[model samples]
Target: MIYTLERTQFFTCGLDEAWAFFTNPNNLATITPDTLNFKVLDTFDTPEIYEGMIINYHVTPLLGIRLSWQTRITEVVPRASFIDNQEKGPYTLWQHTHEFFAEDGGVRVKDTVRYAMPFGVLGTLVHKLIVKNKLREIFDYRQQTLEKILNYPAHD
Candidate 1:
């Protein structure tokens, strides 16, 4: 039940700006929908998020039922790329890689996530029925939010 979700976004901002936005936890809240109630479980300073850093998140993927998520950052190359793996969550194993590259006078941000649901057969069924679509919705919202944020002036 391994699955990979690949997405790419081109931003008008340079590499430094793109890196800053992606690394800053505050930006996550802005992009995430209020419905998910996405919040940082780790202290801002404690999860200084370098390679091998572990971070936790709590969110309700469905109506009123909350899920606790744990992920470890396995790789980091400053502005170039980073990879995160889910240690505990709804997934059996989830590995996500975020890559940044200069492109078309701006920057290209690419995300590749390989994952498997929790239950042997039931989880796979749930993923195909609901979880997969929810994930896509979350990313779609994020993409639009990022486009708006990156297009605006930084000081604004």
Candidate 2:
């Protein structure tokens, strides 16, 4: 079954700072959970993210076994938003969009990810038993780490 996950966080930083930091591919590993063993397999010549940019990486998302994943930047809008789709990955489909907006006293950041697992029915079962929770764990870690890094004020 296809699934979607959306997360938003308000950062007490300027839009430019948020955009620059998020667009830098290297920062991904920093925000990702250590258990995943996420590592970029390709080097980026420049920090700037642009359309058609491809990123390759490997991660041990389960069973401590690593698998390579590749994603391409499908669209980019300067300091506003960008979308990336899986070129080769574990999922049958994956598309993630990152958006940034200038907001009162800071920047609001959002991520929308739509993805589907492989193996048809088995994939759906696995997603129900594992993938669903793993994705939440990963994103939860990211949100906490970003909050610390970006200094978002505490919410009531």
Q: Model 2 shows how many backbone clashes?
A: 0
TM-score (C-alpha) between model 2 and the true structure: 0.96
Give a tens-digit lDDT track for model 2, residues 30-131.
999999999998888999788999999999999989999999999999999999999998999999999999999899999999999999999999999999
Q: What is the C-alpha RMSD of each candidate to the true structure, in Å?
A: 2.9, 2.2
Cα lDDT for residue 7, model 2? 96
Query: Which residue pairs collide, candidate 2?
Result: none
Q: Which 10-residue span in candidate 1 carries the lowest summed lDDT?
A: 40-49
lDDT computed for candidate 2:
0.94
Q: What root-mean-square deviation over C-alphas does model 2 reach?
A: 2.2
lDDT of each: 0.83, 0.94
Which ranges in model 2 have alpha carbons more than 4 Å from their true place? 152-156
Q: Model 1: how far is 79 from its true place, Å?
A: 1.2
